[model samples]
Target: MPKKFEEFKLNRQILNAVEEAGFTEATPIQEKAIGPVLSGQDLFGIAQTGTGKTAAYVLPMLMKLKYAQGENPRALILVPTRELALQIEEQVRLFSTYTDLRTVVIFGGIGPKTQKEQIAKGLDILVATPGRFLDLYLTGDINTRSLQFLVLDEADKMMDMGFIGSIHRILEVVPRKRQNLLFSATMSDLVHKIAGDFLKNPLTIEVAAQATPAQTVTQKMYAVPNFKTKINLLAHLLKDDEFKRLIIFCKTKTVADNINNFIARRFGEDAVRVIHANKGQNTRINSINSFKEGNVRILVATDVASRGIDVSEVSHVINFDVPIVTEDYVHRIGRTGRAFNEGIAITFYNEAERYYIDKIEKLIRQKIDEEEIPQSIFIEETPFDERQAIAREIDAQKRKENPDFKGAFHEKKKQYTSPTKKNNKKSYPSKNKKRR
Candidate 1:
């Protein structure tokens, strides 16, 4: 195994940048993946977040591109989210600082004229989301004939977001002979199918067991009764000084907004910021940057921001609600315990969410330690409507587990309505009977 990054045969400029970045040794993924990528082979890598997978590809890509002399981008990177595109572009810039390589990032939510202007200036590396990339390509602004490398970062995420059609269209446009690299945290069937279409007998690299959480993060769970109790538990947890910098992950924009308001009210406005799809692009970017810079103590976000946003030294990751997407649990907690740092992940699940929690545990291949709810925290009774909703969900889950089993709601409807209808028919007065 290589002791340091220099052993990977990277160019002097990349070496200098890596040293400056303080990466003393190659991470497991980086150590294993850099060689094949540098050898100009198609690669399929399975690794979790914070495994230094970005550098594994970025360094080699930079070395291959060497100096910038192209009228268009020689390499194209497709990410699932705009934040990921921006983050990858930042990484490309960081690694290519000492070199002459130029990088540009294009995504949705901003006017294309600016992106077109940047592309017209010429670049070696172009990082983009599928929608924006295809739009610029179809508009005759981007020239893909010169593309030599194609990378699909977070391939599973792209598939989850229904980008397969865009990916197919992109494949039609880009040169067929270019190298391909795919990186995903989980190797789902969809990912494999896309890989078969994209890669040419690729080298498969699995750094760890698929869908497993990072070992550096300590995982625990709290069984709150309802939304209000969840808030109470969260407030109690935030009181601990250990939770210096934290992220609260919610399932929806509405939940994220509510959590943001609650936290801000309790902890003050200066300490909290919220990011979700509903927020304006600039606002989302600013909130994320603020959290990354430690200007804010807490960030409330939905799953849309879960996969690619990298913040350093995050002390804790709190799941404000159980993610319905089982795989998301891994990515959500991955916000903490980055770069081999010790961090904690606390999840709050009510009775309805336990089904999702079970799926998450099965995906991660481990049970989360259950933490007792403190007596000091207020446990609110589940609201009537919320209780009904929870019961319906539970019944649905039970039916899913056993197809022969009827749901509680179904049984109740059948029992009460059917018997009442039978009784009414049996008791109906006939014309033959005399009036009472």
Candidate 2:
């Protein structure tokens, strides 16, 4: 039987807020993690996305903080990206509705003047990206003397983004006696190294295996021949009403833009939006809001949005390009099958992407079911340039595996004609006649 929130003995005010939030029972991660958090122990958690991990730590921390009487923040949550910072802040606000717990979220891509002002006004919980947090801390706007709880959300992504130095710096500034919580979807070597340094005899929690996708998501893939054909397959899939709300993840900003244009042209302007690192902060926020409100049917984005988005009821997540970083495969598909909702994940891969597909399967410990392309959709022939590109990519992969391996694009040695009597005699006679 699942555990109920009431059994956790939370305060009446927080119970009321939980009831209003419509959360009756605790998720597995929440059930196991909340107790340790409330007991004030350093913890290291390994769970995939959409597992209610945020609330696992947030609720207990809120209960501990109680009435929120502090001039500076008592609890700090650090995330990798601006989107995730906003998402965590939203969660903190929702659960702390019945209390006076003030919250502020700070991130980069915008000026820090307003964020500093908010900090000056006093807050109980501070959610911020590492870079912006360091910036504010350096400016003397943030006080760490009163911090009691520290949480690192998506620690693996933070490591991937090369925020280790910033994290180390933040660790140096914060008080050493505080409780620490580190949550990550995958446990890489780097995460392990940080965990060794960050935690103090912490309790370890593993709700699921590392890099595993949620069971609620059905996985499927198609062997697409070329870029145009992949687009055609996408169009065919979208024609069905079942693909109600979907996110298409691309490998690069250029591909994301191309997909956005194609989808917009086919489904009209309001049906789609694209987001990437180059897009402005307001544009990214507004696009996410539009998608969440159902104003947009499709969102095209790169991996920057992979672990950041928290939308539930997403019908499908399409991988327009296979991620070279295998762990990201888990985060990309995790966007759907959220909140225990049944969802589907579809991937389109060309010949060169098979290498990444294999790595993903190994990481997830499951083989994605492959399906043939529908005959109704026209299969475009691979363009010469695209074919060469694929070949070059394959060669690079091979060279990465073996340094001495020569690529297929290398110059070919001239073939020496064997001494055939007829060919050799004819060559001599032709040479004599030419001389004459």
Candidate 3:
């Protein structure tokens, strides 16, 4: 049975646009969210990315504003990153094509004056990153006092990026009486706090369990001995003709660059590309575009690509490094297996990485099917070694992140434990400098 937009009470114009855009079926998230949103109810929607979330919010917002249009806007959507904000703006324009609505997007990395001018011209829907939105709001250029709808898209990523402070500030400026919709692939404590604060008797529309991996994706693991063998394994997999449009995820910017260099050194410079936190916005966008156009066969990226990457035809996802969080694994694998396409996700594992595997299983709620090691691939190489050196390097990286941390003693590393100091009488002699 073909599902029509009218069945969900979507108006004629939106139904026409959906058909024109070639969307014949409502995705699970949309099917659940659109009805509640159209009736002017607060919603907390949880669904994996590329499942038509942008349209889910945009369609309802557009319908609500169809009978009414005004400058200075009644709706506001906040996203965590500039890429997501712009993507939302693009979708808004597409979905609101038949209407005379004015949707403006504000984000960093560009001059604020232009954004101010666009907002000054009047906006019916404003999609913005939290920082820039606060910037213009503080400047008295943005008037969100009349805002009627607030959508916090990708609430998990927003909290991860430290936007809670800005989100709070923006909420303070906007009218208290409004509809708040929160959408994310995973539900976290941070998300719960926001829901507690912003939503009033909200409808919870969770398409699946939190941190759940998409059913269209099949995940596998390879217990590579160490980093070098991991590289060789990546190379070998890349050389296979079936590995098309691959996104190799690395743990850090340096690792992403290193893996990109390794792939480029053997294969050509154009064969693989890397994007990470240090990349400029233009470079990141260009790399994403080139990869989308098939100019770059492989894209090695950090967590930046874990969200906001909407490409649909990825054939394989290789985790060059295991994800630090299990929720990230779901987002990483979700980059592929989209739009009903079957895709494969492969991860390199070592002894140290085994701890994350169970967490990943528990999050996805399924045991990952293991494949027998292809001995021919390992036969030519020296025997594999567990990643003790890699562990040391990761430990050093952790120390760099938290220098003041005095690590807890582990049974295996007890030999390396430092001796504790005994309290000395001389050290606290009359402990009062003021007495002097």
Measured by lDDT, the strongest candidate is 2
How high is the lDDT of residue 218 in model 1?
97
Per-residue lDDT of candidate 3, residues 219-261 (tens digit): 9988765566677677778889999898999989998999988
The segments of candidate 3 whose C-alpha lies over 4 angstroms from its true place after superposition are: 378-436
Candidate 2 per-residue lDDT over residues 1-436, each given as its tens digit: 9899999958988888888988998889999999999998999999999999999999999999998787899999999999999999988899999999999999999998899889999999999999999999998999999999999999999999999999999999999989999999999999999999999999999998888999999999998878888999999999999999999999999999999999889999999999999999999999999999999999999999998888998999999999988898999999999988989999999988999999999999999999988878787766555765787799899998998888765545112133255643442222111111
Compared with the true structure, model 2 gives a TM-score of: 0.93
Comparing 1 and 3 on TM-score, the stronger one:
1
Q: After superposition, which runs of candidate 2 have C-alpha atoms over 4 Å from their true positions?
A: 410-436
Stretches of candidate 1 off by over 4 Å are: 411-436
Mind sharing the TM-score for model 1? 0.93
2 against 3, candidate with superior TM-score: 2
Give the lDDT of residue 88 in candidate 3.
Answer: 81
CA lDDT, every prediction?
Answer: 0.88, 0.91, 0.79
Model with the higher lDDT, candidate 1 or 2:
2
TM-score of each: 0.93, 0.93, 0.85
Clashing pairs in 3: none
